[model samples]
Target: MGKLYVVGIGPGSIENMTIRAMGAIKNSQIIIGYTKYIDIIKSLIENKKVFSTGMRGELDRCRQALQLSRNNVVSIVSTGDSGIYGMAGLILELKKDEQVEVIPGITASSAAGSVVGAPLMHDNCNISLSDLMTPYELIKKRVELAASGDFVISFYNPKSHGRPYYLKECMGIVKKYRGGSTPVAVVKNALREGQEFQIFTMDSFEEDKVDMMSIVIVGNSNSYLKEGRFITPRGYKLMD
Candidate 1:
């Protein structure tokens, strides 16, 4: 047993990754992650073994990483925070067969939020736009509940090649309860070298502007923008 750091590299950029994530990567003898994610850090794994793949092979990826960790220092990377729709859950599912450490990383939503200040200041829920593992109706219901409850929301797995309409669909669901002018924050390439942050009203965000690499934040009733950043107050008042 060598060390296995299930590190979260954060959304696709080297700059966005923390020193801790870098330290693990630098010390590792092996690196594993999705193919696109691996491409970002290709130079970092010069003399190390690298394993990369896309969807459907996620479980196999985890298994291979786990087995390798038994013999070497292995670092499995997730794009954003590993726990949020990352490799954490999948790794944990194999808990019965293996035990590994899950090193936290800044998730896309957190990075996205930071760009526009704090969109999750008060309370909120995180949801995904992808329907591969879930039903669209259920996702719709979740969006509806989040909208009705006024939860500041951070969305993950927003859109991909054939799923360009998911975000708009979610927006439509939210529009039913929230106004078109409601504030929405979109962060692309968060923390990465070429990061782009956009703050706009939900109804005005162009569908062409989002991609699988992007993260979308839907504001609550109290969420507002200050100096181009979206913020949601924690709602704490002083007793003075």
Candidate 2:
């Protein structure tokens, strides 16, 4: 039987993609992904049979990929690490006995961390503020627990036109545990074209600056800013 490869393209940049991800795409006769992710690797997928769908079509995309993989080498692409909020889980869930290979790549949290500094050097957790698949109440609970535990937090799908206030609400829960001066980094389009980021404190964060393409990192109580870098120290003792 043929094989199905679920590949993470990595922040929509060729350089950021792992060799195995590229190889998986090159080895496949067909490629599948969300429309924007497909456009990101258009150069590498030239002349291949391509399938794409817009947002909210994830199930359809995975179904199509599975069907195609029965007869040909097919690759389904996700923008970041396949296992983290990517298509890998859905693909695996839908397949019964298909040969599947998952290729990992740089996730947005780490990519965003690199541009800002080592904000994820210590204990951290990623929570998606999007309420499509998850309930807002549960998300709020996760944020509260992560914040209370002093875990550096990275939020994905932080804000959107329809869900403009979700991030603000979550930040409110965070404030109960973290101080107003905690560092926050909003990294947009990390490692991609038109990339930009800004650092702000919990009290001064501009909600308008965040969107779906951005990753918002809120520092723990111990996290701080130094020399324009957002850093979360790993509790290492320093020798004087």
Candidate 3:
């Protein structure tokens, strides 16, 4: 039987992509992924059989990749770590008997964390505001709980044109527990061209600056900003 490798290419940059992921793609007979994601590594996949799918076609894409893998090695690509809101879970769930391997890559949270400093150096949680699979209320509850626990947060799939209200709703819940002065980092297109980010207090956060391509990082109560870098201390008393 042929092998199917689910590879995460990190934050759309050649530098951020893992060597293992690139190796899998180079070894595979075919490369498959969302068109946007495939575009990120277009220069690398040159001359390879590439299958590009559109938005909301994840199942179809994975099915195609899996079917093709029955005879030829296939690399199914996703942005960021494949298991984190990527194709690894669906590919595994749909695999009946096909040989599959998941290649880990840098997640958006980690990329965003690095860009904004060390907001996630300690305990943190990730939540996606997109309700396509999960309900908005459930996401809200999670945000509220995370806030109450004083956990640093990394938000993925935070906002899009269709559901702009979700970001506001989630942030409102967070504000109830974390004051308006809480440090937050808004990052878009991490490690990719057109990358942009800004540090803000929770009250000063601008939802208008966010989009589907953005990741938002919120620091816990103990987190603070120094020289424009947002940081959350990991109980290191020596630093004090």
Judged by whole-model lDDT over C-alpha atoms, candidate 2 comes out at: 0.94
The candidate maximizing lDDT is 2
* lDDT (CA) per prediction: 0.82, 0.94, 0.92
Clashing pairs in 1: 10-79, 81-107
Regions more than 4 Å wrong, model 1: 237-240
Highest TM-score: give the candidate number.
2
How much is the lDDT of residue 61 in candidate 3?
Answer: 94
Give the higher-lDDT candidate: 2 or 3. 2
Give each model's clash number. Answer: 2, 0, 0
Q: Per-residue CA lDDT of candidate 3, range 47-164, in tens? A: 8999999999999999999999999999999999999999999999999999999999999999998988889978899999888999888998899999999999999999887897
Q: How many backbone clashes does candidate 2 have?
A: 0
For residues 96-120, write the lDDT of model 2, one tens digit per residue: 8889999999999999999999999
Candidate 3: deviation at residue 221, Å? 0.9
Candidate 3: lDDT of 84?
A: 94
Kindly give the stretch of ten consecutive residues in candidate 2 with the minimal lDDT sum: 172-181
